[model samples]
Target: MKEIRALAFDVFGTVVDWRASIIREGESLGRRKGLSVNWAAFADAWRAGYQPSMERVRRGEIPWTNLDGLHRALLEELLEKFGIEGLDEAEKDHLNKVWHRLAPWPDVPEGLARLRERYVLATLSNGNVSLLVEMAKRASLPWDLILSAELVRRYKPDPEVYLMAPRLLDLEPQEVMMVAAHPDDLRAAAEVGLATALVRRPLEFGPGRSFRIPESGFDLVAGDFVELAQRLLGREATAGPRRRGAPRPPSPG
Candidate 1:
């Protein structure tokens, strides 16, 4: 654990509440346009296109496209599908940048402030670099640097993306811990020798969606980022060491 010199974070749902941010912005747009829509569903629908859009790039079906571009394309499709209209090019463009203004989870700024005192902190998200930079500024997030899929031209769950962070920091993979709300992200990082920490966000999808907490295999699991900071900084104690093995599906929350 002492060898860990840096923490690479998964930003979207891990740090910022993308669902809430997008829904808020979407609802604002709907009100202005006098269009009634399920803003939550719209937010979900926009996010739904995220993975599949990235998959195209991952599979070589399309050339490299940053998250910003992919998000715009997805938003356009969602608007048409949701039957939303009257948004002009400028309005569409402004709405597309909603991702840039995502608010961090309540614990993020304080937690990251504490964590930054101990180690270098940076974003390890699929979001493009510019988007992340804007988000950090808008949300007052304190990141030492911005490292994203755009920097390496590869999305996460890819070994190359996980490997890129350590290389950029001039450290071994084990010297950097990947902090995220998603187990799949942590598992992928762990597979490549980076330490893994899970920060559970039960309502990440929405109020009713089921999100299982990891039963084992991760290096640390905490209820939120502040707890994560406490565990990482040795301020609070966790249950104990976890046995490394396959992750058990979490029971219903």
Candidate 2:
């Protein structure tokens, strides 16, 4: 096996707790507007539309649209379906931008900091660049780069999207590991020659969801980012300060 030179991650469920963050933000929005809604279901519905919306683009039913645009379209439908009303355009825009404010899992910041010591970390997500940038800034996610489907204008599970990371980094496919929580994403990356790691996110859909780990075919599987670092670095990973004079990774363009 080749030594992994960089790690490309799936952002939504894997790096950030999008479901919980959306629910929390939705609840707050509900309170401010005094709207009676089941935010949990709302969050789920919004996310459920994600793949189908992207498929519309992939199938040429619609022209290429970024994730934010797709999300906004879905939000409009959801608002009407859930009987949510009276929100102006500005308020609707802010609510749609909730994806930009998602908080990372508790283990992420520390684990990513530890991993940054030895590897280039980048996001391999369907999210548009601006959304990824704002999310990173808000969460303090230490990504060396933000490579997204928006860059290639194709969503994940597409070979082009998986291949973009290695091409951008000037590395062979084997040298860039794809870390994600979804087996389908990993499988797609593996088919395209990248190394794969499964990071289990059991609560990604909320509580009482059944999650079964894949028994084989991955280079690594860890419970979270911290464990991922420990497995890769072969030591206990901590959220400690970097070594003196260690240069910070370059900011994503």
Candidate 3:
């Protein structure tokens, strides 16, 4: 992995806690509107719209629609489905921008800072450029650059999205490591010849959500960003699953 010089991160659940953040925003809105909806379920349904919406664009059924627009579209449908009413256009717009203000996971900022000390760190998320920029500021995420699907007009698991990062960075695919909590994203990146790192986020969809690492083929599997940084920096080589009982890296203070 000596060739790896930069890290491209999947930002949604990987760097930020999307589910919790969305639930917080939804519940706040519910309280203000005197509605008592299942906020968590609402969050899931809204997120469920995410992939199929992106799929439409990826399949060329729609033009290059940014995430903000797609999110708003889903939000409109969800509002009707959940019997939520009385939200004006402006209020709805504000709610839809919740994705732009997600909170970072506990280990993100510090881990990214440490990793940035040795490698170029950027977001290779499907979020639009504006959404990512606002999220970085809101979450205090330290990103060197924000590369989005808006640039390539494609989403993750698509070769175009994975290849776009290296193309924009002027680096070879092998020189960039794709760090994500999702196996599918990493698998897609690996298929495109980029190095892959799996950062486990067991509660990404909330504590009850079941998650399993589908494979152990990633260059590294870490419980958190701090652990990932340690392994990447120490040049720890891995040819199989991470051994049990390795000392856990402390989260940066």
lDDT of 3: 0.88
Writing each residue's lDDT as its tens digit, candidate 2 over 114-167 gives 999989999999999999999999999999999999988988889999999988
- Residue range 1-253, candidate 3, lDDT tens digits: 6356689999999999999999998888888999879999998898889999998987899988999999999998999999999999999999999999999999987899899887889999999999999998877888889999888777888898898877887778888899999998999999988999999999988897757766599988998999998898777344443457754344222
TM-score of 1: 0.91
TM of each candidate vs. truth:
0.91, 0.92, 0.91
Task: Kindly report which residue pairs in candidate 3 clash with one another.
Answer: none
Per-residue accuracy of model 1 over 1-253 as CA lDDT, tens digit each: 5256799999999999999998888888878899999999999888889999999999999999999999999988988999999989999999999999999889888899989987899899999988999999988988999999887799989998998888888778887899998889999999988998888888889888957676499988888888888888783234444456835344222
Error of 3 at 159 (Å): 1.3
Off by over 4 Å in 3: 236-253
Q: Which has the better lDDT: candidate 2, or candidate 3?
A: 2
